[model samples]
Target: MSTKRKHEVPDQQEPKRKHVEEPDQQGFTRKNAEVPDLQELKKKQTEVPGQQEPVREKVLDHIYGNKFWGPYLSERQWCTVREETLGNCWDSTSYEKITHDSYRWGEDGIFGLSDEQQKLCMGLTLWNGKDSVVKERFFGLTGPQGNLGEDVKELYFYLDNDPDHRYMKALYLYPQTEFPYTDLIEQNKEGFCHSAGKGVFDDGHWQIIVEYTKPESDTILCRYTVTNISTGVQTLNLSPKFWFRHDHDAKHMTDVSCFQVKGDESVVSVSYQLEPDCCYATYKLEVKPGGEDIIEWELLPVGKPSYIDNSSDVIQEWKIKAETFYNSLYDCQWSDQEKAVAKGAWAGLLWNKQFYYYDVDELYHRGQAVENKVKTVKPGNWDVMERNIKWRKHFKAKDILSVPDKWEFPWFAAWDTCFQMIPFCRLDPDFAKHQLLLLLSERYMSPEGQLPGCEFNFDDNNPPIHAWTSLKVFQMTGETDLNFLFNSYCKLQKNYNWWMTNLQCSDKYIFYGGFLGLDNISVVDRGCPPEGYSIKQADATAWMALFALSMVQIGIELTRHNFPSPGDIQKDLIKYLKDFLCISHQLNKDIDNGGMWNLEMTFYNDVLVDQLTEQYIPIQVRSLVGLLPLVACGIVNFSGIRCTEELKQALQTDSIHVCDITCGTVNFSGIGCTEELKQAFQTDSIHVCGVIKVRSLVGLLPLVACGTVNFSGIGCTEELKQAFQTDSIHVCGVIKVRLLVALLPLVACSTVNFSGIGGTE
Candidate 1:
């Protein structure tokens, strides 16, 4: 017998073993046979023909090999905050300036593709043979140039993409005639006059399709199919461009991005030599057009490729895999058309991912040799710029972040990223988890626990959705990764504390400031109300309520799982529940007594309180701000929660009590459609004055909040009876006396026009 364990031997044959359930790298349950003998494991690891590891395994391993190449290239890198060298971002960099200038942060181009870290990038370029310059990057108006803020004028679509970027595709229509670059700039600068540019149907254009497929983890294959949609034959110049992201200092730089070209003109090959002592990628491109008039390329690492399959065959095989992967994601039955829509939506989400790199420390200290050139382009704004960025010296971000709009935003907005992760959680939960954690991590989250809102201004207030989304993602992923739950909960506590300390109004449950991510919808800019007044926003208070509810749920989950300290969780849970009740009490209080709910109109509105006079002036604007409170509802199952004596006592506190379900005839006395509503709608004339008594969606929110519609408590038959017969229904100690007569029918018929409520010139 060997002295060492038989299973540990590198090359020892063993008999068949029984299968058992075990947790994998990502905590996903899988059924696999007992750990194979050392020899069998070694044999499986070796590359054998016609065998490849599953993509799910690759994702679970959390290795950088398969994810090295992706659609991480940004669609727009110009005019980004990182490149705002001048005091003004919009005026400092233009499309023409960016073409010739070097970007210090990242790179962008048409049909762009880059590695995970974006050291070197590869993208497509085109020329119609009549334009002044080749069309490389996308053309979009700067913030001030366009009538609307910033916009991408060209039409394009992200056709397809997998979670792992194993297979991806996109389409762009390029006109044969010169682009309308100068026309757009000149027209928008003068006035709102604009053109749609050259039409693809009338003007001779090329429908270009770009596709990428990975044959192996370390190998990538790209294909471009350009078809002339014109009646006559047309000539178009196409080139695949590759280059390293421009850097200034070479003396201290250890790893350099290098590119080498080889092979003949007919079949050209290029190699990207990455960091020293690491893998290098070699790609073969057919310079000559194939019989189908398409260009094809293959990228391979240093090792020999296992198969010599044709590009078409390889692409078709991966396309099938992509289809299978997407199919597995659907949990319920969906029509083919519905499935197609979902695929397009998910593709856009995955394709918009960009490699975001911003270092505030570098921007603040200006210590790095390459950072010396960072200065205000305007003559006298260096001091102003320094004053603005001085407080954010600890902020540093260098990660693959999901941007809201790569062309327009091209950076993270705190609230938008939280919403994006909801869909992203379905594709790659681990990556989604990483994204949420990245913001909460010490590198991004402030020392005071305020998450950086966006790249432009770190202190700008965004909606508090971080804690809510963190719990959402965790639940979506089968509630695995408790470490994520524990860590996020700890940080979320600090964030919640920060909100209470900073945004809350004088120890009241109401919160102030913030556009609440709803810009231009308010009467005045709610972020900056009239000088002597402070606007208590309905949406802001509702957001805090939701945040508090989410924290309580997270604390309960942690306690149930016996994570670390149950005693601590109980204390935190009491605090969270009490905070939620306080917020709910303020929201539910009568309008005459400083609450958001207006008893006469039965709708929530922002109240402008004069700081000195103490007058509560309600800004009665009908919008989503009033209805946001509906999202703050959550069911508390005391049966599952470890309800201690303290928990029971907390529930019995002021404004917090359990109530039985009650239903009665519909109440139409005080809540019917009023004369002022008819005037605002029938005449199409709007006035901010008068007691506006319109039955908007806000009136029906409380009725829907207590498990009546789209909730669990009400049975189908009983719900219909209550909704039809009952004048009022009360559940869980919330009021629902307002009638939904005019609003519900109007909304159902799609005849409820919001513009009628508030006139637009």
Candidate 2:
């Protein structure tokens, strides 16, 4: 039997018990419940009937205190500093020695350090009145049932003599309302949706506001404001503690030895010499009643620390930027809620941006692993000897902008980066434009003219959507910078050539791997090439067709600008357009001839063409592959076409035919378009294709492709109009569920803007 008192400070000798398996009030067993993955969380929302609910409603409920205390008044979400020991008993060094490595005794750790030594370290502590006896006690979640396990250590604070106490008191107190009043508002209107919670705290009614911001600079800003609310004179002493963990990068332990701390009447500063040419500084403000202070913390290369003196100016500059950003949104006719969501989305994008450095050798090894996987099915052909050689010779670890969820996906994906630019272009066009160039830069792009699929896997192929993204950004911004267009065209042309040379299965069709970002949606394993035959992917061919069309548009732009290469560009553009049209015609002919189209079923599916037999069989799955033709379809004005009149007429004829095929085959109604095509659609039976059954990127591709169809000329029936309205409502209900699908309904309808129905302006 072990002798250990509940809530008492744990000793090393205390026997550890196995984690209990008790189910909580929510029926989640503590031991068995794993943190849900993204897919599982999404599935829970769509599969469960009542799981989908507006987060705003829940936030409002918390504010009213109907369900629980509002997040503003609670410290549950706030991160806490904890004391942690690195090595276990199994290590060469004892656990006791590891704990004492950085530990200091008495005043030497506090006030005895020299000014030069103090310049390298910083700390935060809660100090009580000098008269009281100091009592040391530990406070943290420390049980099998508690949030944090027993092994984890936490930092403790001392006030006067009271060490075992909650020193941080943050609460919202509004006299007029029965419950505390709190509002989620943008901190800087000019900034990319920096959200701040505004509330009043304490009986004295000190206004407490917490705001977070991430500038283009590497540092993250967390600002707190406390304003005195009471008229009477009051005295309060509050100190927040901070401890720098030595375990962050053990390779930098010698650098950690250079850390020092210093304090004055109004400020406490900590500094660390990170490298021979790098230093980091952290400052905490000591503000009184009626005054506000900002703590400026940043890690920078070794230089004169001007940010310390200019912290106020840095904060003001961000404020000014935020103001400008807010004013831009104000100019647009958007609801407060819609604007809030947009801001939040922008904030998420900004917050998630990180500067990542990769080791070329490690990346090369990872790429080799990917190539080995491919070689299992298609030996010799999939070997990445050239890529490995290129990486070993030219690649060096350098910082790059990583714009994905750093925790889930640290590396950038070629096509995912294009989608990332969509939101970023709205916030910062320069950054977005630079991102497009970065992927095509000589450093990132291979000598073979291939843009790497991702950092880990170089051989995998993502869709060629960079040109499409570029065109959209250019059109949105009305940017006429010739350099951007010229450079983009040149890079995109090389990328196009690489794809045609390496991926083309036939003159018209292209092959793609599973890196297209739609996982497990195809009939045959797209990642695995068939043993003896080339696989023709409808999506891959369609993407290439779109890529070719983008190039043609770029060429036309160059010609309009009178660029030196316009004559050759125009000739090349004409050839690319002709190729696209031929591919479209071939796909249309294949559907008609290959028995892939079920006229009775009225659905077009992907066909698996057997290379040896010269025969094609239909892949019966109803997926995005069927809708890629629509994405490939684009219309050019008569003036834009530089091809011969005969070729131009043939292209137009093919376009209209492809449009008809796409519109007719995509069964919006679940009844499969047999009766629904001839008669009025049963309003109840008209289901959005892949809306409920398979919720994926593939399902949303139809809505993305909606812009290609000329809806006005389609001769819309009364039933079709009614179905559109009904489907829009359904989409609106689940708008908060998926970010990509949220914009679909708005993009689908061209004539009438759905502004009244929460569509983005």
Candidate 3:
């Protein structure tokens, strides 16, 4: 019996009771026992340190305020093809024209921020008292000026960023002396090293740390920490710029909204009817030797500068929240340095998002006019431009996209976007899904089911990885969003039809197209072969096989999820599975005629065919092109499906035959030599295919091919059993690789005791 205190209520009266342990018989408490406070337990379970759950919930609910502003600004807007009205892009635009001339497409600056549509933009400008012009945008070499192609000549680091764009930070170092703009171009032209005998960072530079914080959904705060790293005092002019783009839409609003400086040059306000009336307020701190000098700017409503009086407190509070947000993502055992590296890598990805805008119709007509001018001046000099600008009437891009680099390769590349979305799925799945859909949309994709490879060349065939990435994003996000799945499947089917119709040359089901984005990898230009001959591509065919399999997966999910549609989904699903088997069959068919596999080389290679003579020659180069076939391997588990006998029979084919053939070459990919393969096998030659055999990533590719199949619903047919046996042999052989033996033991204690291969003891 327990007696209650004055503050405690009766057990019957209370809705919930506290958890307590019963005492043991020896007049002692039980081991690991204590009375738990219900209120404290509830608080500990529900409360996160940074309260990022509410922000994430807001993101899920599609609250536009939380995502209204972000780092969607381009680092370099000049020298892009969208800005050029005539001639080549690099020759028409320069760094000098960025400040005075209004851009036709988009805006750019140093560490900038913009809205979703990029109508209103804000960026930072700097002057170190020695340069000829204000450092508005980053200065880099043109493609003709640099030996290693175009590159940025500035030093910048991305520090931190959140998924919701709530808090962002970056660092840009500016040299205090006169910038070596001309010397950098000339030195890069001469050789790799600078001819002026000076590196860019070899001189004394000023470290400027930039950060953006949003306390409220409508308010944005910016801080720039300018530190003097020179020996003596230096004068600096820093301006936080805010302007509307000089496009067709904003040209009318320019007369209505003008900048007004108030309160002794500390505040700049802009009033507009269409957009929210905003004001920028600044607060500066005194500078000292080896000390930090701060300049803060707040962008909010015209009347809402309440945080301006105590901006330091607001900045510190948001900084603590950002630190707490990142700290919650790590485990207690991870070191601080390891966490910082992971954070920096993610920050770089988030900062690379840029607003890409290009109208292909505008480019084509303008290019046609430019070509006429060139033909009149120097006849036959512009034939290439005239021929290349023919089939680009359907491409038009105006959206915020992830780029490889904002300074170099600013426009979106179809293949690069696939890899970029993999990381983006972890950061923001909604943005990832949107990015995947944008490429397949009608605005960018042609009516003939052709997706633009990039801005420079629309006709070039990038690897068909969009379906693979769509399925990846689906699996990574726990298979939610059925609408995204359905839409992706429908659009991808059209793109697949385009590939089959345009790329396949021979009835042998071989594929060859212009430049599958692997430039300079082959010995000869695969895009433009020596006129009369065509090269059969191994990678292109393998990618098509993977695309067929991905379509099968998406079709299976759509049928399984009970999506309400009138059409026969299962029939289409069966068609995709059959397509996969056919493509795989053709891939491993014959090496002498037009097949991809090379028997003497013991690898896959592109088959070069002579059109008139009907000759097939294998270009024996052991590169990634050979190993790409392994990525086409996957397992399809058809357990809970209600299908007809036709669909069931199609699923029971020998899907693992390619896996066995690729795995047989595992012995040839050895360190020095092994007796088991020599004793167990019979081959004609023992030539070494590669020097780093079985040590590089090529060795592990076979393991990806060995997927454990389970045909639970369909009866155990002979072909199914054969595939299982082949896969088991491939799996056992792959597990014997030395690198995998050391790794698999730490992850799982499974043994490879298949009937064909011996024990791993």
Candidate 4:
């Protein structure tokens, strides 16, 4: 036998495999025997053509490839994905359509749906039968054409009758080609279904999940088996009665989310809340008892995807022909591997957020999870929990599966997917790779080369870190497909260009700043900039530098293939960087080239709007901005005498540089063991006010001092790293300071000179 395992795929065949957690990767069950004559007892292997050797998905496990608590919905876990809501709150006239562009929560209230679009926004009603079984139904697609490429696995069951029973329904509908759990479902109804006239939780009776994909399919496809507790055997005797598709069509508004039951026992009667938008749905299930020859059918939702805009025949016109089906999703099939790859063509959506949310706030302020599973119902019901009540969403065990797919459900972002990719890799590398491919697809990447931001809009520029993340992924697994990744690198450059040109405000560099990306929004506007900061913002400036660095690094990788130059696209990057450092004196250095360096402050306090409005603003030199010079790594092209020896000297221990801004006092960042920048950070006399006294500014000094733009080098000093890694840093300035801190080491500790940090030759 060859030294390599006989089963081990050849090098020309595949890359080194890392066993991930996707059951589908290694799980060729007995169902396979039923589907085909193939059988293997002593470890037989069947190969799916395009499927990569069964490497366990490492990164996907955390986000998209999530492991549910109980009986997980399916083998294909909920990996972190990106999407946007199809439309504004469905109550609006255009409920069927998705929001044409992307969006962010709270940025613009999703209150577009008015009282008019009643059909799209009608309240849900649980029509309780004489058996006390309340039922509602939703048909995802009308037929094979209607399936919408859904690789169904688990159910997201939630209770919508009360505030506690939340609504959080969104689906990514992954492709079966990459990773599929088709065998996850029970073949037959098995034993018995729950009896009617019963209720669950607080005196309710209902259940869902029907054993059917289509009606005419030879697979005995749609079987609904239910057995009433009181009439167990008798109920099992009943045949399934699923209504025909041509009969009545309906699409259920998302209502509830359920993973699995403790024992699949019958103590729970499903109920419904009558609120205008209370989520509501009906389903079927399987239960095998002591003596049942074959599986049977039970009760299901009243309707399937039965309703369409009879008012307009637009949807009817949408047809599926092999020749005609390219862009639209109407004809896509889950099983067709080729179509799966193509239809998943999203533009690079959630790139900037890949590394984020590793430890962001997954918990709500109310000591509950910030996430909540949703079931769709009427429109008004959603506003119910829109209050300050934060809930832990069901992204698998409330343990955050990857990063969220922000901007509703239709369009998710790029970077967020990367963060998601980390954990998802553990469950199914195939799925994890697909998620990456999904982001790289044409839809998610914009015409301008920008990938989708964290929000729904593909146009908006969020953070610029896609290419770097792609490399990180490549490093973890040498599955380098330069062709595809280079395209992502190109798109990332566009985003970088947009970040610099569009968001930049000052003649000097600083990105957008505000609560929701609005300019002038102070850092203290929400403790962290909330949306993001102004380009001219001190922190924003540093971020711009860091983003530019990522672009250069990734751009170099793509450059090898002679990828087209992004033009003078990012040519002006260094101009403002050098200008800002010299004029702003972020490090408090003065002299030469008409520089205007500002001093550091001693504390952390909001720059009162009234002070600026009244022309009485305190122009204190602070460490926050002083350390900004540390942000100019690999972006700014230095020219002339802009960078004086005086400026360079200030970075050392010989002189004391100031950089604070609390109570009108200046403070500093980027302190070395004995560097001049160290004095201001260590000085204890710096009076700081606030309920939490350990001034965050003092702790974040290392970030600026050890200036290196690499994500690993962020907060290079032990103390700064401790604060970021140790968590629980609840200071208002912490996020911004951390962001700046994260950027500085890239510049401060960089091999390049400060003036040329942003690529100034």
Candidates 1 and 4, the one with greater TM-score: 1
What shift in Å separates residue 540 of candidate 1 from its native position after superposition?
0.6
The TM-score, computed over Cα atoms with residue i paired to residue i, of candidate 3 is 0.72
A best-first ranking of the candidates according to their lDDT comes to 1, 3, 2, 4
User: Each candidate: how many clashes?
Assistant: 6, 16, 0, 200
1-761: candidate 4 lDDT, tens digit per residue: 00011112123232222211111211111111111111231133234343322321221232112111111011111121211122233222121222122111111111100011111111112232232222121212111211222222222222111000011111111111111112222211232212110122122222322221111111111222232222222211112211100100013213321111111344422332212211122221222222222222111111222212120131122212211433343344455776545333221121111211211122121121112213221122222323212112221111112334221222234555676565444333444655675555544454444445543233444445555466656545554656555655555656566565666543334344322222323334422432333113444544555555555444444433334443232232233224333323332222111112322332211222232232212223344443544534432112222323333343333232323311122212111123323333455644322111223334556666432234343435656655655353422323323345232222322222222212111
lDDT value, residue 191 of candidate 4: 26
Q: Number of the top candidate by lDDT? A: 1
Residue 396 Cα positional deviation in candidate 2, in Å, after optimal superposition:
4.9
Worst 10 residues of 3 by lDDT: 745-754
- In the predicted model 3, the residue pairs found to clash are none
Decreasing TM-score order of the candidates: 1, 3, 2, 4
Prediction 1 global C-alpha lDDT: 0.65
True-vs-predicted CA distance for residue 95, candidate 3, Å: 1.9
1 or 2, greater by lDDT: 1
Task: Name the regions of candidate 4 deviating beyond 4 angstroms.
Answer: 1-90, 93-411, 425-446, 454-461, 513-539, 556-761
* Runs with alpha carbons beyond 4 Å of true place in candidate 2: 1-317, 362-397, 519-523, 529-534, 590-601, 610-615, 638-761
Of models 1 and 2, which has the larger TM-score? 1
Model 4 scores a C-alpha lDDT of: 0.29
Q: Residue pairs in steric clash, candidate 1?
A: 664-726, 665-726, 665-727, 666-726, 666-727, 667-727
Identify the leading candidate in terms of TM-score.
Answer: 1
